[model samples]
Structures are given as structure tokens and as C-alpha cells.
Target: MNYYKDNVSTNVVTSNCNYVVTVKDWPAFLNEYNNFSNTTLAAYNAAYLQLGGGGNVAPGVSFLLKFGAFLNLYKADPSSDEYMPLKLNQNNA
Candidate 1:
């Protein structure tokens, strides 16, 4: 998905740190699954849990996927799944 371009419309600094929203009918949902401000990692985990438990099967605003949750936790290795400092550790080892 072109998750970057559109989300920047909302906030650029938080764009790279955002999670993609796959729930198609989120605008119709409520409670713990409604607020746009619910961008924490915990909130993101909750949403995915709900989906795994048989939530909606449709795609929401395809453009707003990365706009739902905040994803900038720790630094990631740009070239791999390892943490950002993994390469440094490897070299020193």
C-alpha cells in the first residue's frame, strides 16, 4: 500500500511511526476501536487481536493503514528484522 504519501497529510513526523489500519468498517465501530488517537502499541495489539478473533474482513481506507497506530518503538535494522544496533553488536563481537 502507498501508506506513506497519504498519512503525511495528517502528520509527517508520525508517519514513519504509524501502523496500517486494515479494518474496512472502522468508521462504523466504537469503544476501544473508534478513536483515531488510540495510536499506542497496546491499542494496536488489541485491534489485531480483535481481527484474529473474527472481526471485519474488509479493507478500510486503504490509504489510512499506516495512519491508525503509532509504530515507532525501538530502532529497526533498515536492512533486516534485527534491531538497529544489531549490526554494531555483530561487528564488535
Candidate 2:
């Protein structure tokens, strides 16, 4: 997820059943998450690379910038409602 300016945000969600599995056990959930991260990151990186570069930045630079900005915004105003209403949609079998 990424936050822009005061109240704007964006995110990416995968429809793959293997992603974001809901399990009661923390360890199992984390293990599944780790696996998903590896696959998702690889796919994202590939697609990002195909988009070419942005000026002096690399293909994945835009995503990194947005993520960094979001982190900064969160750090600045953690209690702000601008970051609320976290919308998470799970797509899986």
C-alpha cells in the first residue's frame, strides 16, 4: 500500500488463492505469507522491468518512492484519519 499527500492511498492485491491465506496459527500464516511475498515480488519485479525506467530511476523506482512516501506520512501523523478505513479485500479459494 502507498499513501499520497494528505488522504490519498493506493494498493495492490492478488487474486491468487495462494496469497493472503487466513489461518488461525501465527507461524503457519507467517510461513504462507513469506512464500507469497517471494512469488509476488518476483512477478511484480518482472512486470516493473518491462515498463522500462523513469528518468534516472529504475523500473521499480516508482513503487519504492510511493511506499517510502507512505512510510514518511505515517511517521509524521500516525493518529491522522487520513490513513484510516483500511480496505483489504481477500481473494482466494
Candidate 3:
């Protein structure tokens, strides 16, 4: 089954934040999951827990798989995962 994208959030700055519903459907799912407003690591853990069990075989396998895909994508793209620190050139600029 195709895992549809859903609510996604990212933090532009560090602070306690709330998730804004950036997108509602497929297009929105991709857009928002790729780009977020204020979702936290702890929040993600909680969500994962709420999903029941771990791995793609868990209760909400589809949803978890979609999240896993987004996580991979987030790791791959710099502009996407703001939580990731930019690698600074060792040479003094």
C-alpha cells in the first residue's frame, strides 16, 4: 500500500513549539512532511510509541513507513532537516 504523507512540522528556531497543519492531503502531505514547522524529537518518539510497537511491521505500519521515508529524505537533504547542523569548512573563512 502507498503511504500517504500527512502532518509534518519543523523548527526554524529552538523552543517549545506547536505543529501547524501545513498540508491536508497527498500534495500537502509531501510538502509538509518534507518541510515542517515545530515537531520535536521527543514528540516523534511519543508518536512512534502511540503508533504501537516499532519497525515497519508495527500497528500503523503504513504511517510509520511513511515517516521512515520522510526521515531518510530529511537526512539526505540539508534544506529539509533544519535540526541537522551544517558542516562548516575546517579552513578559517
* TM-score leaderboard ranking: 3, 2, 1
Q: Write the per-residue lDDT of candidate 1 for residues 1-93, one digit (tens) a residue.
A: 446433432222232343222332323433434564568878775665465343432222212233333322223323434432111123221
- What TM-score does structure 1 among the candidates reach? 0.19
Model 3 collision count: 5
Candidates' C-alpha lDDT = 0.35, 0.35, 0.38
Better of 2 and 3 by lDDT: 3
- Candidate 3's TM-score reads 0.26
What is the Å distance of residue 72 in model 1 from its true position?
22
TM-score (all chains, Cα) for each model = 0.19, 0.21, 0.26
Q: Answer with 1 or 3, whichever has the higher TM-score.
A: 3
Window of ten residues with lowest summed lDDT in model 3: 84-93
Note the clash tally of each candidate: 7, 0, 5
lDDT at residue 47 of model 3 (Cα atoms):
66
Candidate 3 per-residue lDDT over residues 1-93, each given as its tens digit: 243344454433223322222223455455755544457768766666655444434222424344433332211233333333222233311
Task: Give the best candidate by lDDT.
Answer: 3
